[model samples]
Target: MIICHCQSISDQDIRAAVDWMRAADADTIITPGKVYHALGKRADCGGCMPLFLDTMRQCDSFGVATAAERPPILRPARLRLAQAR
Candidate 1:
């Protein structure tokens, strides 16, 4: 279940990274670059992007948070402005 042949990243690696990221910051947006950084690797080719994203989404905490769930920092600027006012 290797997701990225170029980086030698497996599905398990992706999942572990995702889970760790979720645990570290529930409000953080998980991306391929972040995953690569987490695993101490770099993206060498663009071919694995689609599959990489798929594997990331498979994780339980891999989507945009609802309005209520979103951290204040992640809220839309307009929403923040309204709240501030």
Candidate 2:
């Protein structure tokens, strides 16, 4: 269950962080760095990245919703620029 040994981060911790971040800002993109920051920890060794990412993916709130799922106003700048062109 421990995803990052260096940071003493567990799968549950990752999930909780992800959930909290999503709740705080629904449109914010969740990343490993953000998760670490949310947990008040930082990555030491780079080895845990693979497992860390896997754990993040398993979290329900980990993935950002696709353009179709998000409101038009919330779409990324690139998408809006493409549309404008």
Per-residue lDDT for 1-85 in model 2, tens only?
A: 8888888999999999999998899878788999999999988988999999988888888764477465557788888777778
Clashing residue pairs in candidate 1 (N, C-alpha, C atoms within 3 angstroms): none
CA lDDT, every prediction?
0.88, 0.85
lDDT of 1 by residue, 23-42 (tens): 89976788899999999999
For model 1, the superposed segments whose C-alpha errors exceed 4 Å read 64-85
What are the TM-scores, per candidate, against the unseen true structure?
0.74, 0.74
**RMSD each, Å:** 3.6, 3.7
What is the TM-score of candidate 2? 0.74
**Candidate 1, after superposition: displacement of residue 63 in Å?**
2.6
Instruction: Name the lDDT value of residue 21 in candidate 2.
Output: 94
Cα displacement (angstroms), candidate 1, residue 65, comes to 7.4
